[model samples]
Target: MRRHILPPVTRPILLLFALAALAGCGPTAEPAKAAADEHGAAVDEFERGPHRGRLLRSGDFSVEVSIFEEGVPPEFHVYAYRKDKPVNPRELTLTMELTRLDGRVDRFSFAPQGEFLRGAGEVREPHSFDVKVRALEGGRAHQWAYAAYEGRTTITSEAARAGGVTVETAGSIVMAELVDMAGRIEITPEGQADVRAWYPGRVMALNAELGQTVRKGQVLARVESSHSLQTYSIPAPLSGVVIAKNSNVGDVAGGEALFVIADPTKLHAEFFVYPRDAERVRAGQRVEVRTLSGDNRVVAPVEAIVPTADIASQTLMAHVHLPPGASATFRPGMGVEGSFQVAAWPTALAVRTKALQRFRDFTVVFARVGNTYEVRMLELGRQTPEWTEVLGGLEPGTQYVTDGAFLIRADIEKSGASHDH
Candidate 1:
C-alpha cells in the first residue's frame, strides 16, 4: 500500500516469507508421517535374508527368522547378519510371541546354537499366527511383528448365514465301525416255494403271470398227464408273488418247477464279507441294509454266518433277518448295501463328516466362537459315513461348521489369508 518500492534484498525476503506461509496453509505433513508410522516395519517380499527366512532390519543389522523342522520338533531359527556378514550368535538373544487365531498365545525363548539361535519349545501346526520377534541386542531390545497366515479366516455371523453355513457342536457319539459289503435281498427258506408239476404232462394251460400275486393252493396252471391223459392242477405252494413262470400254454411239463413264488414281506439281507472282514463279523451283530437309492435303510440283526465261502470271490456269507414288518420296501433279488457294525465305541468327541476340511497337510474343522470361526486340527479315529470320531485337537461341546465349510475355506483363500513359511 505504501507506493514505495522495496529494495531487492527486502523484496526477495518478503517473497520467501509469502511462499512459506502458503506452504503452511497447504495439506498438513501429519498424514504422510502417520501413514509411515502406521506401516512400522516393511516386509521385503522379494528379498529373503540369510538362512532363507524373513528378514527384519534395524540400522545395518538384520535378523532372519524361519521355522526349521528337520530331524527335530518344529522350532524357530533366527540368524543375525550385519552387512551380509554373519553376526556372532552370542550377540543376540531372541524371543517370539505367537498369537494363534484361537486367541491363544505361545511364548518361546531362543538360545544360541552352533551358529544361530533356536527356539526352546515346539511350534504347533497349522503355523498360522501373528508372530512377534524380539531380539535382545547389546542389552537393548529390537522388535518386529508380522502375520504368518495359514488356513485361517474370519467371517461375520450375518455373512455366514447368508453363505448358508450351518454349525453343529462336537460331542460324544456312539459310532459303529462299519464294514461295507455287497449284498442282495433274499427270500427266507419258508417264504419261498417252487410249484412243481405233479406228473409228467404233454400239454398245459398256464394261469399265473410273472410278478403276479397268488394265494396259497391257488391253481397256477393246468397240466395233462401223458400216460393217463388226465388234466391236473398246478397250485401255488405259497401265498406270495409269482417271481418265475416256467411253463407256457400247451408246453410239456415234467417233474420240474412250474412256478416260483416268494413272499416279499419275509425278505432277508445276505452280505458277502471278505476274509479281511469275516473274522470281525459275527452272528448277533447289527447290520444296516440300504437300497441302491440310499434313501431306504433297515436295521437288522445278523442271523448267521454261513459256513461256506464263495469260491470265486473268496467271501463268506452273512445273513441278516428282516422282521415281518421291516421288509415292506424290499423285494427278492434286489441289490442292496450292507454295513455291518463290526466294532463300536463311545467317543468323547465327534463331529459330522461334512464338517471336515482339508487344510494344508492336516484335517481341520471350523469351530465357531461368537461371530468368528477358527480352524481346529483334528486327530481322527473311527469314521462312519455320517460321523467321525475325534481323537484329539477338538474339545467336546465346541460348535463347528458342518455345512458350507468349503465355502468358508474358499472365502479365506480368496482373501489371501493363507500360510506361507
Candidate 2:
C-alpha cells in the first residue's frame, strides 16, 4: 500500500470527521446488538414501533405488536417487516403466548386482516406478561420471546411498611341483613306529665325554670286561690325534667297547663318503616339505633309496631325502648336512624370493605404472596357496614392487602407495567 501524506491542517479535519462518523454509528449499532441477543429476544425499553408497541425481532424479520382498543375490546395488532421492508402479512401466520405474573398462561392466535393480523378475543387488563411470538413464513418457524410488562411493580417489605400498607387474612363472618329507617327519640306518653292548676289561682312566685329537674309534688310555684284569696303552693306532678314553663310570677292561673315535665330516662326510639319494609318490621326483632351523625349507637329490641300507618307518608311506626342510661347521650326529639335486622347468614369467606377495589371490570383484592402482591378477583354476596361476604374467588386464610391497597395500585400505574394485555 502507498502512503499519501496530507497537510497537518487537513489531517485534524479528517480526524474530526472520522470521530463524528463513529459516534453516529454508536446509536445505530445499539438496536443491532439488541436484536443479536439469544434467539433475537431483546426488549428495547425506550424504543417503540410506528404503532407505539413492542418491537420483536428474529433474524431478518421484525414484528411490531400493539394493543388497539378503540371502540372495541382490546385485541393484538401485529405488523411484520423483513430487513426494513414491509412484508406481506398474508404470507405469514403469527401466534403469541403470554404468561402473567400470577402464573396465568394465555395463548392467542392472529388472523389476517387487511394489512396486518388481529388476535382473537379481548386481551385482559393490567397488562403484565412474559411474551413469546412465533411467526411461520415459507414453511419455516421464526420465534422470539421477551418479558414485556406494563403497569406492574414490586415493593420491598420495608417500603411497604413505611407506606402504611397493612394486610389481613380472609375468613368467615356472621353478617346481618338490615332494613334501615329514619327515627326519632321520643318520651313515652306515660313518662311525660303536665302540671295544671288545681284551682283557679294567681301565680305568686315561680321557682322551677325550664329544663330543671323536679321531684314528685315538688313546689314549682306559689299561687293565690281566686275563690278564697288564700296563697297556696303549686307542685310538680311527676319527678322529671321540666321541659316547658308557661307561668310567670304574679300571673293568673286557670285550667291551662303551667309546666310540662318529661322523664328522659324513659325515652324510646320511634322509627318509621316505609311501606316496602313495613312487613319486615315486627315486634321483638333486634334493632340498632344511631344518631344522624353516626357518633352514637344503641342496640335495642323492637318493643312494638304500631297498627296504623301514617296516612301521608304511608309508613308504619316501630318503637324501640331505650335503657335508663340512654339519657346521657340522647334526648327527647333528637333525630335518629335505625336498622332492623331481618335475616342473618354465616359466610365461609369474608373480608373488610376496605380491602375491596375496582380494577378494570373486576372487583379485586390484593393477595400478598411472599413479597409479591397478586390481584385476586372477588365474587361478592351480602354486604354489611364493616364486612363483605365473599361467595367465591377467595380462599380462607389468604392474606390480602386492606389498608393501603390504593397506594400499591398507584405504584403499579406509575411503573407503567400494567395495561390491557
Candidate 3:
C-alpha cells in the first residue's frame, strides 16, 4: 500500500477505509459527567504533559494520563499536580471509563505506583475511543470527558461508489495451494511428422522448401528407386510447416529423413517437476499456462507425465496439451510459466487478502453497517496469497473493503487523527 499521506486540501479524504483507521483517540467532550459513556472529534492541538501524554487541565488541579505499554499489556498511568507542584498520588482516588464505537464501555480503577497511578485493566489495542476521567481530591471532584478517533472516517454512499470503492462479503473460501514451475511450449509428438521415402531411392526433385506450409499427401519430392530405376512421388505426411529439410534435389533420400513437419496448432507446455513435487503431479490435473510476460494465458489439463526423470536435473516432466485456439500466442520453444493446483483447503470464514489493512498492532478490515464502516481486528489462521482464514474477530457475512481501501486510510490520516498515545 502507498504510504504517501495525501494532503486533505486536494479532497483526498474518502470514506471507503472508514473502519480500518480506528487506532487513535482524540478531543475532550460532553460537559455533564456521563454516568456511562463514546469520528470521532477533532482538537486543534492536544495539550501534552511532561510525560508526553494528553493533558487534562482545570485551574490548579490537572491529571496527565498515559498508556504505559512498552513490555506489558497496555495499562493507564496518571500523574497529578496541584498549584503547579507535584502532588501525592496516594491522596487521590482515580477512575476512568472508555466507551468504544460499538457502545461497549470498559471501566478501570487506579492504585498508586511510586509517583504514578496504575490502572487495573488493560487498555487494549487500537486505543481509539471516548474516555471519561473522574478524580477525587480531598473535598472536590474533577470530571473530564473527551473523544478520540483514528483510522475512522465517513463519506456519503454516493461519493464512495463514485470513487470506485468496492466491497465484498466475508465468507467461506477454498484456498488453492499452487505449485509454480517454469517450462517452454513444444509440439506434441502426434503433431510432428518425420518424412521419408517409401523405398530406397535418390531424391529426383525435392519441391518443399524449409518453412513451407504443406498439406497431407502434397507431393514434397520425386524420388527414383535405385533398383526399379522408376520415379515415385513422396507426398507430405501432415498439414504443417516444413521445419527441417534433410535432403534436397540430387541428394540421397532413402537412408535419411527427407523433412520434418510440425503443426504449430498442436502444441503443449512441458514443466519440470522436482522429485519432492513430482509425486503430487498426476494426469487429469488442471494447469494454468502463461507466457513469461503473462500477456497470454490458458488453462489445460495435464495430458501426460514422463515416467523417467532427466539424467542431469533429476526432474520429471509434466505435459499439458494446449488447445488449438492458443496457437496464435502459444508457440513452440516459447518460455512459459505453469501454476499447477496441487492441493486445496477449505475454511468456514475468510476474507480477501487484499482487503486486510494495518491497524495499530493488528490486521484489520472495515466492516459496514448501512452507510457507516468500522474496524475489526482479526485473529488470522491459515493463509494463501489470495485469501486468509479468519479464525476470530470478523463475523460471517460481514461486508469488507476489497479495493480502494488504502485511499480510505489516507483520507482518515489526512484528518490529522492520531491513535498513538
lDDT of 2 at 131: 73
Compose the digit string of candidate 1's lDDT tens values, residues 124-190. Answer: 8767677777777776556766666655556666667666778988899788888888899889998
Residue 312, model 2: Cα distance from true site in angstroms: 2.0
Off by over 4 Å in 3: 1-9, 12-41, 44-150, 155-169, 367-373, 395-399, 416-421
Full-model lDDT, candidate 2: 0.74
Task: Give the runs in model 1 whose Cα sits over 4 Å from its true position.
Answer: 1-164, 197-207, 217-235, 248-254, 292-296, 323-331, 358-362, 379-387, 413-421
Compared with the true structure, model 1 gives a TM-score of 0.57
In candidate 1, where is summed lDDT lowest over 10 consecutive residues?
A: 10-19
- What's the TM-score of every candidate structure? 0.57, 0.57, 0.65
Decoy 3 TM-score against native: 0.65
Q: lDDT of all the models against the reference?
A: 0.74, 0.74, 0.78
Q: Number of the top candidate by TM-score?
A: 3
Error in Å for residue 310 of model 1: 3.1
